[model samples]
Target: AQSVTQLDSQVPVFEEAPVELRCNYSSSVSVYLFWYVQYPNQGLQLLLKYLSGSTLVKGINGFEAEFNKSQTSFHLRKPSVHISDTAEYFCAVSAAGNKLTFGGGTRVLVKP
Candidate 1:
């Protein structure tokens, strides 16, 4: 399956709690990985990306991701997430292409 996997479609958490959204991919060729966050009725913002080098990559809003070739995974992790972090996260892949094939998306809900 040359597709992306978002292990959780919906995740509810208390405010200022740690959260991890799992992402795995199956592809024969190398691909560019990306994590994007989208708020309600808003466009996507690039949370992070694993482009060429570096197994561990950091991005905006205190989010980071690790690229694993063997496991074919690039999981996103945040030590402590805020209420503003509540949004829809999408994992995507693009192998030398501009178009991105996104997962179903994981919803992160932060409770008060």
Candidate 2:
């Protein structure tokens, strides 16, 4: 079984500031990591993913994450955030032939 944990429930940051959202997962088998964002009243959209190849993966909206296999962590980061970036972020893990297990979610509030 695989599970994801988001250390923070909410992250408040000023606009144009850097932000990082912590995510950790546990799985017995090898798994793929992903980050998704949900805007207000909107469905989730894929932000980034780490299936193979480079440990550092970049995604849309200037977001990026590093897959640390040993630590079982895939934390999301943005060098400079914007007010439009305010949304709910979710981390997920999926193994071969298995469904994705998502984290509780972290709400990012970017204030102007």
Candidate 3:
């Protein structure tokens, strides 16, 4: 079995500021890590993923995450953020073809 933990429920940052959303997972078997963003009143979109290979993976919208196998963590980061980046971010994990286990979610609030 696998589970995800998002340490923060909400993160507030000023526009153009840097931010990092924490995400950790626990599983006995190998799993894939993913970061998804959902804008207000919109569906979730894939931000980045770590299926295999390099521990450092980059994704859309200048987002990147490092997969630490030993730590069992995949934290998403961005050099700078925009007001439009305000949304709910979810961290998910899946083993093979199994269903995904998602975190509680982190809501990013970008202010002017």
What do the candidate models score in CA lDDT, each in turn? 0.92, 0.95, 0.95
- The residue-by-residue lDDT of candidate 2 on 1-112, one tens digit each, is 7889999999999999999999999988889999999999999999999999999999998999999988989999999999999999999999874798899999999999
Model 1 Cα lDDT, one tens digit per residue, 1-112: 3689999999998888889999998788888999999999999999999888999999999899999999999999998989999999999998665568899999999998
**Each prediction's Cα RMSD?**
1.3, 0.7, 0.7
Clash number for model 2? 0
| Candidate number that wins on TM-score, 1 or 2 | 2
* Top candidate (TM-score): 2
Q: Residue 59 lDDT in model 1?
A: 91
Task: Write model 3 residue lDDT over 1-112, tens digit each, in one string.
Answer: 8999999999999999999999999998899999999999999999998999999999999999999998889999999999989999999999775898899999999999
- Candidate 3: regions farther than 4 A off: none
What is the lDDT for 53 in model 1?
Answer: 92
Judged by lDDT against the true structure, how good is candidate 3?
A: 0.95
Q: How badly does each model clash, as a count of residue pairs?
A: 0, 0, 0
How well does candidate 2 score on lDDT at residue 10? 100
Clashes of 1: 0
